[model samples]
Target: MSDLILHHYPMSPFAEKIRAVLGYKQLAYQSVLMPRVMPKPELQALTGGYRRAPVLQIGADVYCDTALICDVLEHRASTPTLYPPAVKGATRIIAQWADTSLFWAAMAYNLSPKGAAALFAGTPEAVAKAFVQDRAAMAVGMTRLRPGDATAAYRSYLRRLANMLSDQPYLLGDAPSLADFSAYHPLWFSRVINPVMADILDATPGLLPWMDSIAAFGHGRPAELSPLDAIAVAAANTPAPLADEPFVDEHGIPLGSRVTVTPEIFGHEATEGELLAATRMHYTLRRQDERAGTLHVHFPRIGYVLRKAEG
Candidate 1:
C-alpha cells in the first residue's frame, strides 16, 4: 500500500470528520492542504473530476465522497470498527441521515449572514466573496433551507442527538461509531469555525460533553505534503488490484464500458472513464491524465449516478 494521503483544507467540516476518524484509528497519513474553493487542478487530476474535500488517495486509487471514504478507512483499520455489528444497520442509516439532512441544516444556519461574517472575520473581502461564490455554484441545483427554517431544524436535530446520548457516551452506544462522527462534524463547524453562532448548541446541554469527548481523539499524526508532491505520489504508483467480487450491475452497464459517474446532487462534476468494477457497494473507474498518470477513482453507489458517456 502506498502512503495514505488526504487532500483537504483546515476548515472543511467533512474533512474534520475524516481527521477525527483517522485519530481514532491512530493512522499516520500525509496531508495535502488543497484549495478550499475551485481550481483544484492537482487534486482533480487524481479524482478525474470529483472535487469534494478530504479525498483519500491510497496508491493510485482516489476515493471520493465521505460516505465511501469512511468505509475505506473502516476496512483499513477494523480494530475499532465504525460499524458495530450489534447496531450496524442502525449506525449506517443514522449516519446517512446525519451526513445529509443534519449537515445541510447546520450549514445553512452556520453560514447565515452573522455566522459568515464571523467565519471570514479579518479575511480579505475579495477572498471571502470568492469562497461564497464557489459554494453558491455547488448549491445551484439543491434546495437550500432558509436561515430561520434551518435554525429550527438544526435545533430539533441536536435535541434528537442529545436524546440518543441519554444513557450512552456516543450516539449509537458507549463506543464511538460512524453515527457519532457523522453527527459531530456539522456541530464542530458551528462551535469551532463560527463560534459567534455556537450558542445554538447551548440549547442542548448534553451535547457539549459529547462533543468534547469526540474532540479528544485529536487528528492523528499528519505531516504536510505539497499539492504538487501529492500528485507526483500518484504518478509514481499504480492502483491496487480491484476486489475479486462479482459485478453487481444495476445500471445495465458492463465492465470495460466507458461511463461517467456523477454525484446526484451537489458537486455535479462527472468523472468519465472505463468502468472497472461495480461491486455491491461502489463503482470504480480507470481514468488517466498526463499529470497523475493512470488512476482508479471510486465512488459509493448510493449518492451517485452512473451513466455511459455520450459520444
Candidate 2:
C-alpha cells in the first residue's frame, strides 16, 4: 500500500472534513500543502486542472471531493466504519446534506460582517478584498443565503443536531459514523475560523460537548510532504486500481473525449483533462502536467458537472 497523501490548505473547510475522517480511521498519511489560488503548478501536474483543496493521493490515483475521499478511506480500513451497515443509507443522506446544504448555510452565517472582520482583521485591505473577489467568483450563478437567513438556518440545524444527540452518543449509534463527521466539519469552520459567528451555538449546548468529542480525534500523524514530492510519488507509482464498473452515458458525452469537471457552487473552478473514465459514481480524467508525469484526477459525480470543453 502506498502512503496516504493529502493535498490541502489549513483554511479549507472541506479539507478539515477529510482530515477528521483520516483521524477517525486511524490512517497514517503524508501532508502536501497546495496553494489556495492559481498557479498550483505541482497540483496541476497531478490533477490536470482540478485545483480544489484536500485532494487525496494514493500513489498515482488522485481522488477529488470529500465524499469520495471518505469512501476511499472507508474502503481502505473498516474497523471504525464511517457507514455502519444498519444505517448506511440514512448516513449517506445526512452526510450529503451536511456537506452541501448545511455547510453553505453555516459558512454564510460564519462569514457575516462581524465574522469577516474577525477573520481578515490583521490582513491588508487589498488582501481581504482580493479574497472576497476570488470566492465571489467561485460562487457564480448560485444564490447565496443572506446573513440573516443563514443565521436562522444555522441555528435551526445546530438545534436539530442537538436533538439527535439527546438519545445516543453519536448521530446514529454508539460509534461515530459518516453523518457525524460531515456535520462536524461545517460547525468546525464556525467555531475555529469564525468564532464571532459561532455564538449562536450557545443555543445548543449539547452540540458543544459533541464537538469536543469529535475534536479529540487528532489528525493522525502527518509527515511533511510538499506538492512536488506528492506529484513525484504519483509519477513514480501506479494509481490505485479502478473498479470495473460500466460507464453510464448521461450527458450525451461519452468516454475518450476531452472533458472538464467543475464544482457547481462554491469552488466553481474547472479541472480539465482527458475523459478517461466516467463510472456511475466518479469521473476520471487523464492529464499529464510536466511536473507530475501522467496522473489521473478523480472526482465524484455529485456536486459537480461534467461536460465536453468547448473547442
Q: lDDT of each structure?
A: 0.92, 0.85
> What is the C-alpha lDDT profile of model 2 across 54-134, one tens digit per residue?
789888888888998988898899888998999999999999999888999999888899889999999999889888887
lDDT of 2 at 13: 86
Q: Please give the lDDT score for candidate 2.
A: 0.85
Off by over 4 Å in 1: none
Q: Residue 72 error for model 1, in Å?
A: 1.3
Q: Pick the candidate with the highest lDDT.
A: 1
Candidate no. 1 TM-score = 0.98
Question: RMSD for each model, in Å, please?
Answer: 1.1, 1.6
Distance from true position, residue 194, model 2, in Å? 1.7
